[model samples]
Target: MTVEYRPIVPKIKRFKILVIKIVFIVLGRAFQSASQHDEEIKREISSWRDGFTLIMKVMPDGPYMGLEKKNNMLEFKGSKLKQADLEIYFRNVESAFMIMTPQMGSHQAFAEKRMSIKGDLGIATAFTRALVIVMSVLYPEFIVKRLVKRVPPLTIKRAGLRVWLYTLGIVLGR
Candidate 1:
Protein backbone atom coordinates (compact mmCIF):
# COMPACT_ATOMS: atom_id res chain seq x y z
CA MET A 1 0.00 0.00 0.00
CA THR A 2 1.16 3.53 -0.81
CA VAL A 3 0.39 6.72 1.09
CA GLU A 4 -1.12 9.56 -0.94
CA TYR A 5 0.25 13.10 -0.64
CA ARG A 6 -1.95 15.70 0.94
CA PRO A 7 -1.55 19.43 0.36
CA ILE A 8 -1.93 21.87 3.22
CA VAL A 9 -1.16 24.92 1.09
CA PRO A 10 -4.75 26.02 0.62
CA LYS A 11 -5.54 25.97 4.32
CA ILE A 12 -2.35 27.85 5.14
CA LYS A 13 -3.10 30.46 2.51
CA ARG A 14 -6.59 31.01 3.84
CA PHE A 15 -5.32 31.49 7.36
CA LYS A 16 -2.71 33.97 6.26
CA ILE A 17 -5.33 35.90 4.33
CA LEU A 18 -7.59 36.10 7.35
CA VAL A 19 -4.80 37.38 9.56
CA ILE A 20 -3.76 39.99 7.01
CA LYS A 21 -7.33 41.24 6.68
CA ILE A 22 -7.83 41.58 10.41
CA VAL A 23 -4.53 43.39 10.88
CA PHE A 24 -5.19 45.87 8.12
CA ILE A 25 -8.75 46.57 9.20
CA VAL A 26 -7.58 47.55 12.67
CA LEU A 27 -4.78 49.66 11.24
CA GLY A 28 -7.12 51.37 8.80
CA ARG A 29 -9.47 52.38 11.57
CA ALA A 30 -6.66 53.76 13.67
CA PHE A 31 -5.13 55.70 10.81
CA GLN A 32 -8.42 57.19 9.68
CA SER A 33 -9.34 58.28 13.18
CA ALA A 34 -5.91 59.74 13.84
CA SER A 35 -5.95 61.70 10.60
CA GLN A 36 -9.28 63.21 11.47
CA HIS A 37 -8.06 64.54 14.83
CA ASP A 38 -4.38 65.20 14.18
CA GLU A 39 -3.38 68.03 11.95
CA GLU A 40 0.10 66.65 11.36
CA ILE A 41 -1.18 63.28 10.19
CA LYS A 42 -3.76 64.93 7.95
CA ARG A 43 -1.09 67.11 6.37
CA GLU A 44 1.19 64.16 5.84
CA ILE A 45 -1.49 62.20 4.00
CA SER A 46 -3.00 65.14 2.12
CA SER A 47 -0.36 64.93 -0.59
CA TRP A 48 -1.35 61.41 -1.46
CA ARG A 49 -3.91 60.85 -4.19
CA ASP A 50 -7.54 60.73 -3.16
CA GLY A 51 -7.77 57.05 -3.98
CA PHE A 52 -4.24 55.99 -3.13
CA THR A 53 -3.90 52.35 -2.17
CA LEU A 54 -1.24 50.52 -0.22
CA ILE A 55 -0.92 46.76 -0.04
CA MET A 56 0.85 44.74 2.60
CA LYS A 57 1.59 41.05 2.13
CA VAL A 58 3.25 38.36 4.17
CA MET A 59 5.38 37.26 1.20
CA PRO A 60 6.28 38.46 -2.26
CA ASP A 61 3.46 36.38 -3.74
CA GLY A 62 1.04 35.61 -0.96
CA PRO A 63 -2.23 36.62 0.61
CA TYR A 64 -2.44 40.40 0.94
CA MET A 65 -4.48 43.20 2.49
CA GLY A 66 -5.15 46.61 1.05
CA LEU A 67 -5.62 50.10 2.51
CA GLU A 68 -7.34 52.69 0.39
CA LYS A 69 -7.37 56.41 1.13
CA LYS A 70 -10.29 58.00 -0.64
CA ASN A 71 -11.66 61.48 -0.12
CA ASN A 72 -9.52 61.89 2.98
CA MET A 73 -11.04 58.75 4.41
CA LEU A 74 -9.11 55.56 4.92
CA GLU A 75 -10.57 52.08 4.57
CA PHE A 76 -9.03 48.64 4.75
CA LYS A 77 -10.18 45.54 2.93
CA GLY A 78 -8.84 42.19 1.83
CA SER A 79 -7.39 41.78 -1.68
CA LYS A 80 -8.84 44.58 -3.74
CA LEU A 81 -7.29 46.63 -6.53
CA LYS A 82 -4.83 45.34 -9.13
CA GLN A 83 -2.13 47.89 -8.30
CA ALA A 84 -0.99 50.07 -5.45
CA ASP A 85 1.44 52.91 -5.00
CA LEU A 86 3.27 50.94 -2.34
CA GLU A 87 3.56 47.29 -1.38
CA ILE A 88 5.27 46.11 1.78
CA TYR A 89 6.23 42.45 2.04
CA PHE A 90 7.10 40.70 5.24
CA ARG A 91 9.29 37.65 4.96
CA ASN A 92 6.65 35.43 6.54
CA VAL A 93 3.57 35.38 8.73
CA GLU A 94 5.68 35.59 11.86
CA SER A 95 7.46 38.67 10.62
CA ALA A 96 4.20 40.34 9.68
CA PHE A 97 2.70 39.51 13.06
CA MET A 98 5.73 40.88 14.87
CA ILE A 99 5.39 44.31 13.37
CA MET A 100 1.61 44.41 13.32
CA THR A 101 1.27 43.31 16.90
CA PRO A 102 3.99 45.69 18.20
CA GLN A 103 6.18 42.79 19.19
CA MET A 104 8.91 44.60 17.18
CA GLY A 105 9.28 48.09 15.90
CA SER A 106 8.91 48.64 12.17
CA HIS A 107 12.32 50.25 11.88
CA GLN A 108 13.91 47.27 13.56
CA ALA A 109 12.04 44.90 11.28
CA PHE A 110 13.32 46.78 8.23
CA ALA A 111 16.89 46.82 9.48
CA GLU A 112 16.74 43.13 10.36
CA LYS A 113 15.59 42.20 6.83
CA ARG A 114 12.27 40.88 8.00
CA MET A 115 10.45 43.26 5.69
CA SER A 116 10.91 44.63 2.19
CA ILE A 117 9.32 47.41 0.21
CA LYS A 118 8.38 47.79 -3.44
CA GLY A 119 7.13 50.76 -5.45
CA ASP A 120 8.13 54.32 -4.55
CA LEU A 121 10.40 54.47 -1.56
CA GLY A 122 9.41 58.04 -0.72
CA ILE A 123 5.75 57.18 -0.58
CA ALA A 124 6.51 54.19 1.60
CA THR A 125 8.53 56.30 3.97
CA ALA A 126 5.78 58.87 4.31
CA PHE A 127 3.25 56.18 4.92
CA THR A 128 5.45 54.60 7.58
CA ARG A 129 5.80 57.96 9.32
CA ALA A 130 2.06 58.37 9.30
CA LEU A 131 1.69 54.95 10.82
CA VAL A 132 4.03 55.84 13.63
CA ILE A 133 2.01 58.94 14.33
CA VAL A 134 -1.15 56.91 14.35
CA MET A 135 0.43 54.52 16.80
CA SER A 136 1.21 57.40 19.11
CA VAL A 137 -2.43 58.30 19.06
CA LEU A 138 -3.60 54.77 19.74
CA TYR A 139 -1.16 53.66 22.43
CA PRO A 140 0.25 55.08 25.63
CA GLU A 141 3.41 57.19 25.56
CA PHE A 142 5.52 54.47 27.06
CA ILE A 143 4.31 51.95 24.50
CA VAL A 144 4.69 54.37 21.63
CA LYS A 145 8.21 55.19 22.71
CA ARG A 146 9.11 51.52 22.56
CA LEU A 147 7.62 51.09 19.10
CA VAL A 148 9.12 54.10 17.36
CA LYS A 149 12.72 55.09 16.82
CA ARG A 150 12.11 58.62 18.13
CA VAL A 151 8.86 59.62 19.70
CA PRO A 152 7.66 63.03 18.63
CA PRO A 153 7.26 65.61 21.31
CA LEU A 154 3.74 65.61 22.69
CA THR A 155 2.23 67.64 25.47
CA ILE A 156 0.38 65.72 28.15
CA LYS A 157 -2.85 67.44 27.24
CA ARG A 158 -2.46 66.65 23.54
CA ALA A 159 -1.62 63.04 24.17
CA GLY A 160 -4.59 62.67 26.45
CA LEU A 161 -6.88 64.16 23.84
CA ARG A 162 -5.56 61.86 21.17
CA VAL A 163 -6.06 58.80 23.30
CA TRP A 164 -9.60 59.85 24.06
CA LEU A 165 -10.42 60.51 20.42
CA TYR A 166 -8.93 57.25 19.29
CA THR A 167 -10.91 55.37 21.89
CA LEU A 168 -14.08 57.16 20.86
CA GLY A 169 -13.45 56.30 17.24
CA ILE A 170 -13.08 52.65 18.07
CA VAL A 171 -16.13 52.64 20.34
CA LEU A 172 -18.27 54.29 17.70
CA GLY A 173 -16.92 52.12 14.93
CA ARG A 174 -15.42 54.98 13.02
Candidate 2:
Protein backbone atom coordinates (compact mmCIF):
# COMPACT_ATOMS: atom_id res chain seq x y z
CA MET A 1 0.00 0.00 0.00
CA THR A 2 1.19 3.49 -0.81
CA VAL A 3 0.14 6.66 0.91
CA GLU A 4 0.37 10.15 -0.59
CA TYR A 5 0.13 13.35 1.35
CA ARG A 6 -0.49 16.93 0.22
CA PRO A 7 0.35 20.19 1.94
CA ILE A 8 -1.97 22.02 4.23
CA VAL A 9 -2.84 25.38 2.76
CA PRO A 10 -4.17 28.40 4.56
CA LYS A 11 -6.95 30.33 2.96
CA ILE A 12 -8.19 33.79 3.78
CA LYS A 13 -11.94 33.71 4.05
CA ARG A 14 -13.82 36.10 1.79
CA PHE A 15 -16.62 36.43 4.32
CA LYS A 16 -14.14 37.78 6.84
CA ILE A 17 -12.98 40.45 4.43
CA LEU A 18 -16.54 41.30 3.52
CA VAL A 19 -17.50 41.70 7.13
CA ILE A 20 -14.49 43.87 7.78
CA LYS A 21 -15.34 46.10 4.84
CA ILE A 22 -18.87 46.53 6.10
CA VAL A 23 -17.66 47.32 9.59
CA PHE A 24 -15.25 49.89 8.19
CA ILE A 25 -18.08 51.56 6.34
CA VAL A 26 -20.14 51.84 9.46
CA LEU A 27 -17.25 52.93 11.66
CA GLY A 28 -16.13 55.57 9.17
CA ARG A 29 -19.66 56.87 8.92
CA ALA A 30 -19.96 56.88 12.69
CA PHE A 31 -16.81 58.95 12.91
CA GLN A 32 -18.31 61.52 10.61
CA SER A 33 -21.43 61.60 12.75
CA ALA A 34 -19.43 61.81 15.96
CA SER A 35 -17.51 64.76 14.61
CA GLN A 36 -20.74 66.56 14.03
CA HIS A 37 -22.67 65.71 17.20
CA ASP A 38 -20.12 64.69 19.85
CA GLU A 39 -18.26 67.48 21.54
CA GLU A 40 -15.24 65.39 22.46
CA ILE A 41 -14.70 64.24 18.89
CA LYS A 42 -15.15 67.74 17.63
CA ARG A 43 -12.53 68.99 20.06
CA GLU A 44 -10.08 66.35 19.01
CA ILE A 45 -10.49 66.80 15.27
CA SER A 46 -10.70 70.54 15.53
CA SER A 47 -7.12 70.64 16.72
CA TRP A 48 -5.83 68.78 13.69
CA ARG A 49 -4.67 70.79 10.69
CA ASP A 50 -6.97 70.91 7.75
CA GLY A 51 -6.45 68.14 5.16
CA PHE A 52 -4.95 65.73 7.68
CA THR A 53 -5.69 62.15 6.70
CA LEU A 54 -5.73 58.93 8.66
CA ILE A 55 -5.77 55.54 7.03
CA MET A 56 -6.51 52.18 8.59
CA LYS A 57 -6.07 48.93 6.72
CA VAL A 58 -5.01 45.33 6.92
CA MET A 59 -1.48 44.60 5.85
CA PRO A 60 -0.34 42.74 2.69
CA ASP A 61 -3.22 43.28 0.29
CA GLY A 62 -6.41 44.09 2.16
CA PRO A 63 -9.28 46.51 2.18
CA TYR A 64 -8.69 50.00 3.49
CA MET A 65 -10.71 52.96 4.73
CA GLY A 66 -9.71 56.47 5.59
CA LEU A 67 -10.87 59.79 6.97
CA GLU A 68 -9.64 63.28 6.30
CA LYS A 69 -10.19 66.49 8.13
CA LYS A 70 -11.40 69.01 5.59
CA ASN A 71 -12.93 72.36 6.36
CA ASN A 72 -12.98 71.49 10.06
CA MET A 73 -14.97 68.34 9.45
CA LEU A 74 -14.08 64.72 8.87
CA GLU A 75 -15.06 63.12 5.61
CA PHE A 76 -14.70 59.50 4.60
CA LYS A 77 -11.88 59.05 2.11
CA GLY A 78 -12.92 55.64 0.74
CA SER A 79 -9.28 54.54 0.47
CA LYS A 80 -8.59 56.49 -2.66
CA LEU A 81 -5.36 58.14 -1.58
CA LYS A 82 -2.21 56.07 -1.52
CA GLN A 83 -0.67 57.74 1.51
CA ALA A 84 -1.77 59.39 4.71
CA ASP A 85 -0.38 61.48 7.50
CA LEU A 86 -1.21 58.64 9.89
CA GLU A 87 -1.47 55.01 8.87
CA ILE A 88 -2.68 52.16 11.07
CA TYR A 89 -2.12 48.64 9.83
CA PHE A 90 -3.51 45.40 11.21
CA ARG A 91 -0.98 42.66 10.63
CA ASN A 92 -3.43 40.40 8.84
CA VAL A 93 -7.06 39.86 8.07
CA GLU A 94 -7.44 37.72 11.18
CA SER A 95 -5.98 40.44 13.33
CA ALA A 96 -8.14 43.01 11.62
CA PHE A 97 -11.17 40.81 12.15
CA MET A 98 -10.42 40.46 15.84
CA ILE A 99 -10.13 44.19 16.32
CA MET A 100 -13.11 44.91 14.11
CA THR A 101 -15.22 42.56 16.19
CA PRO A 102 -13.70 44.55 19.02
CA GLN A 103 -12.68 41.36 20.82
CA MET A 104 -10.12 43.74 22.31
CA GLY A 105 -9.44 47.43 22.17
CA SER A 106 -6.87 48.99 19.82
CA HIS A 107 -4.53 49.58 22.77
CA GLN A 108 -4.36 45.87 23.44
CA ALA A 109 -3.97 45.15 19.77
CA PHE A 110 -0.99 47.52 19.61
CA ALA A 111 0.53 46.00 22.72
CA GLU A 112 0.21 42.52 21.22
CA LYS A 113 1.90 43.68 18.01
CA ARG A 114 -1.19 42.81 16.06
CA MET A 115 -1.47 46.43 15.03
CA SER A 116 1.11 49.04 14.09
CA ILE A 117 0.92 52.79 13.85
CA LYS A 118 2.90 55.04 11.54
CA GLY A 119 2.68 58.67 12.49
CA ASP A 120 3.27 61.22 15.21
CA LEU A 121 2.91 59.76 18.71
CA GLY A 122 1.18 62.79 20.14
CA ILE A 123 -1.46 62.77 17.45
CA ALA A 124 -1.87 59.06 17.92
CA THR A 125 -2.55 59.57 21.62
CA ALA A 126 -5.12 62.20 20.88
CA PHE A 127 -6.73 59.92 18.31
CA THR A 128 -6.84 57.17 20.89
CA ARG A 129 -8.73 59.39 23.26
CA ALA A 130 -11.13 60.34 20.53
CA LEU A 131 -11.56 56.68 19.65
CA VAL A 132 -12.36 55.84 23.25
CA ILE A 133 -14.88 58.60 23.28
CA VAL A 134 -16.44 57.31 20.08
CA MET A 135 -16.58 53.73 21.34
CA SER A 136 -18.19 54.88 24.55
CA VAL A 137 -20.97 56.52 22.66
CA LEU A 138 -21.26 54.01 19.84
CA TYR A 139 -21.66 50.97 22.05
CA PRO A 140 -23.93 50.33 24.95
CA GLU A 141 -22.67 51.13 28.43
CA PHE A 142 -22.32 47.46 29.31
CA ILE A 143 -20.35 46.60 26.20
CA VAL A 144 -18.24 49.72 26.33
CA LYS A 145 -17.31 49.08 29.95
CA ARG A 146 -16.17 45.59 29.11
CA LEU A 147 -14.09 46.61 26.07
CA VAL A 148 -12.16 49.64 27.28
CA LYS A 149 -10.34 50.75 30.42
CA ARG A 150 -12.52 53.79 30.97
CA VAL A 151 -16.09 54.04 29.87
CA PRO A 152 -17.28 57.58 30.01
CA PRO A 153 -20.56 58.01 31.82
CA LEU A 154 -23.58 57.73 29.56
CA THR A 155 -24.78 61.26 29.80
CA ILE A 156 -28.03 62.37 28.22
CA LYS A 157 -26.11 63.83 25.29
CA ARG A 158 -24.24 60.62 24.62
CA ALA A 159 -27.47 58.63 24.79
CA GLY A 160 -29.07 60.92 22.28
CA LEU A 161 -26.02 60.76 20.08
CA ARG A 162 -26.20 56.98 20.14
CA VAL A 163 -29.79 57.09 19.02
CA TRP A 164 -28.90 59.43 16.20
CA LEU A 165 -26.04 57.18 15.15
CA TYR A 166 -28.20 54.11 14.89
CA THR A 167 -31.06 55.88 13.23
CA LEU A 168 -29.50 58.36 10.83
CA GLY A 169 -25.76 58.57 11.08
CA ILE A 170 -24.87 54.94 10.51
CA VAL A 171 -28.00 54.07 8.65
CA LEU A 172 -27.60 56.80 6.12
CA GLY A 173 -23.84 56.38 6.00
CA ARG A 174 -23.22 60.04 6.63
Task: Indicate which candidate wins on lDDT.
Answer: 2
Clashes of each: 0, 0
Residue 42 local lDDT, model 2: 84
Candidate 2 local lDDT, 1-174, one digit each (tens) = 898899989887899999889988888888887788788878888879999999889898899999999877688877786789999899999999998887778888889999999998788888888888878877777777776888877789989988899899876645
lDDT of 1 by residue, 63-140 (tens): 677777877866664477556778888998778877877778889999999989988888888888888887776667
TM-score of 1: 0.77
Residue pairs with backbone atoms closer than 3 Å in model 1 (clashes): none
Please identify model 1 stretches exceeding 4 Å from their true place: 1-21, 60-63, 156-161, 164-166, 171-173
| Regions of candidate 2 where Cα sits further than 4 Å from its true position | 1-9
TM-score of each: 0.77, 0.91
Worst 10 residues of 1 by lDDT: 9-18
lDDT of 2 at 164: 90
